[model samples]
Target: MSSAVISISNQKGGTGKTTLTMNLAAGLARRGRTLVVDADPQGSALQWAGLSSDEKPFPVSVIAVADNLGREVGRFAEDYQYVLIDCPPTLETEVTRAAMRIADTVLIPTLPSPVDLWASLRLANAIEEVKLRNPRLAAYILVNQLEPRSALSQGMKQALEEFDIPALNSHLRRRAIYRNAALEGLSVYCMGKRGEPAAAEIDAIIEEVL
Candidate 1:
């Protein structure tokens, strides 16, 4: 079977979208071929891959197409077993629409807050609009930066359910390790090669997605 193309997106920024995309791509790469498309103008994911420097951890080829990404994405499908598009924050961008239009699945990452939930709903609507162009697109939300043992996290989970968006049972908790790993141009999947919480979380997300 061909690999699934999943776009990690959100309307509002600073929701750990790039962070999750890179880590998840690395996690899935352990099992099969994976390519990451850095469709965001910020190029954070590409930078995180250490592409800004002369050296990179591995050849994670990232296409720096921010404007006309839809056309570029079609070309990406033939190259890898999985193509994970890390979209720009705003859904208004054509790159975001392109990723949504071709994605086999769209993973929206959101914080556990009312404002974030509202933004997520808007993102879901946008994904639906793109689905009109490609009826096979499947979409869902994954709760990010969740603080375990907190009331806010509990409330947000309930609100997401009420919104009727299917959420992954595995929620990513707020942790500094994620940031630290990014700086090293390494993902938790690689950082935890010796065994760590970050690695375990990444593995869980991969299992859920698969």
Candidate 2:
């Protein structure tokens, strides 16, 4: 199979893009080859990998390339079955466009809120822009930091439906464990194969994206 490149992107900050990217990387890595490219200028994903001067290495390798992701990713894609790009929260950046240009699919993470929904549209438009150049590009929106049964989540879901965007049924719920796991360079799925709420959601994403 040609390596499937999935970019976890959002034009707004704190949308859990990196969280989803990292966890999905871990989940897929267990099954087969996976590589994560941190295309964010902030290097948050790199920091999360916990590479220090003393050790100078990490379980997952992350490179700082906020400018030329397509070139960097092209070089890395030969060795991996899947390449996951953790993008910055800006569409105007070249890295985001480069990622979108090369991606087989783009996973846009949005919170179930009006503000997030608005931001999601902007990201969606950017994806569309990339699609114009690469007509075969596939993209989907995944809800993150969501609270089920709340009026806001319901309203946002309804709003998303009004638009033509395909939103994934599986969502990442608001939980403290997500925060805790990032500190250890681990995904919630690593907590266990059983009784792990996040694993189901991550699996759902894999099913939909694949």
Per-residue error for 151 in candidate 2, Å, reads 1.4
TM-score per prediction, in order, is: 0.91, 0.91
- Model 1 segments more than 4 A misplaced: 51-59, 193-195
CA displacement after TM-score superposition, residue 108 of candidate 1 (Å) = 0.6
What digit string (tens of lDDT, one per residue) describes model 1 on residues 44-78? 88888764345537436566776666667677666
Q: What is every candidate's alpha-carbon RMSD to the true fold?
A: 2.2, 2.6
lDDT agreement of model 2 with the native = 0.80
Name the weakest run of 10 consecutive residues (lDDT summed) in model 1: 51-60
Model 2: how far residue 45 lies from native, Å: 0.6
For candidate 1, the per-residue lDDT at 138 reads 76
Residue 19's lDDT within candidate 2 is: 91
Estimate, for each residue in 1-210, the C-alpha lDDT of model 2 and write its tens digit.
557888888888899999998889877887778888988878888888772343433345566775667777888777888889999998776777788899998888898887788867777777778899977788888889888878998898888887657888888898777787787666776565432888788888888778
